[model samples]
Target: MARLYHAPLSPFCRKVRLALAEKRIEVQLIEERYWEASPDFLRRNPAAKVPVLQLDGRTMAESSAICEYLDETRADPPLMPKDPTQRLEVRRLVGWFDDKFHSEVTSKLLYERVNKKVTGQGYPDSGNVKAGSKAIKYHLDYMHWLLDHRRWLAGDVMTLADFAAAAHLSSLDYTSDVDWNRSAVVKDWYAKIKSRPAFRSILADQVPGFRPPPHYTDLDF
Candidate 1:
């Protein structure tokens, strides 16, 4: 069995967990306080990041790399497309969410509201929270635009791109930061993805000192 060191609400960790669960790979989920950077944890990931995955006799650090490695090795219920063009698009969208969306929205909102408190980093920054709240509207509009044309974020099929976006959105949704009513198409798309069995574990996650909204576990919501 594989083992994962993760923070319960970290989107990157959540993304990797989704991929593993989608592939039906049983894993041990060990919550790690990466901020503390203990010697054992640092040895697992020199970068001191959550989601250090121990699989196939190797320790993996980066979430994207770990997920891709799993997809390549498992090959069942693939998370990436066969076509190079489609794969490129998937990678693009993954980068969009993990990089752009993360910087603009997640780091501001989730990090402020939940992570800071959990890590003993003091109170949430109201300015960052406000900016994150405002920025999510634009991101939701972008998702709406994508879903309106493509069946999924990258193309006609669900790919790692969808997981990447969902990872961020789900984290935000946990904090009730997402306005589901902002776009019918986006909400519907999320509903479809949220209903997947892979999302079950994610929805079941409970963090101390932070409670999810009622709709967080509601698949129909």
Candidate 2:
């Protein structure tokens, strides 16, 4: 069995988890406080990242790379599209959520409201939280636009792009930060994805000192 060192709410780790679960890979989930940077953890990942995966007698760092490696190693139930153009589109949306959305929304909101408390950094920065709250509306609108045209974020099939987007959105959803009523299309897309068996662990996540909203695990919500 593989082993994963992860932080339950970290979007990157969550992305990898979703991909692994989608591939039906069984892994031992070990919660790690990457901020503390234990010697063993640092040895596993010099970067001190939460998602250090031990699999196939090798250690892997970075969520995107790990997901790709898994996708390559486990070809069945593919997470990436076969066509080059389609694959690029999937990668684009994955980067969009992991990099752009992460910087503009997740860093501001999750970092302020949750990470700070977890890391003992300080209280939530109201300005950053406000900015994140405002920025999410634009992202939600963008998602609505995408869903209006395609069955999924990147194309007609569910791909890694959806998991990447869901990883971030689910983290925010845990905090009740997402406005599900903002766009019915986006909400419907999320409801569909969230209903997947791969999302079970994500939905069951319990961050210390933080309680999820009742609707967090509600499939109908």
**Distance (Å) between predicted and true CA of 47, model 1?**
0.3
Candidate 1 wrongly placed segments (more than 4 Å): none
- Please, what is the whole-model Cα lDDT of each candidate in the order they appear? 0.94, 0.96
RMSD of 2: 0.6
| Error at 37, model 1, angstroms | 0.3
Q: How much lDDT does candidate 1 score? A: 0.94
* TM-score of model number 1: 0.99
Residue 160 shift from truth in candidate 2, angstroms: 0.6
lDDT of 2 by residue, 155-183 (tens): 89999999999999999999999999999
Cα RMSD (Å) per model? 0.7, 0.6
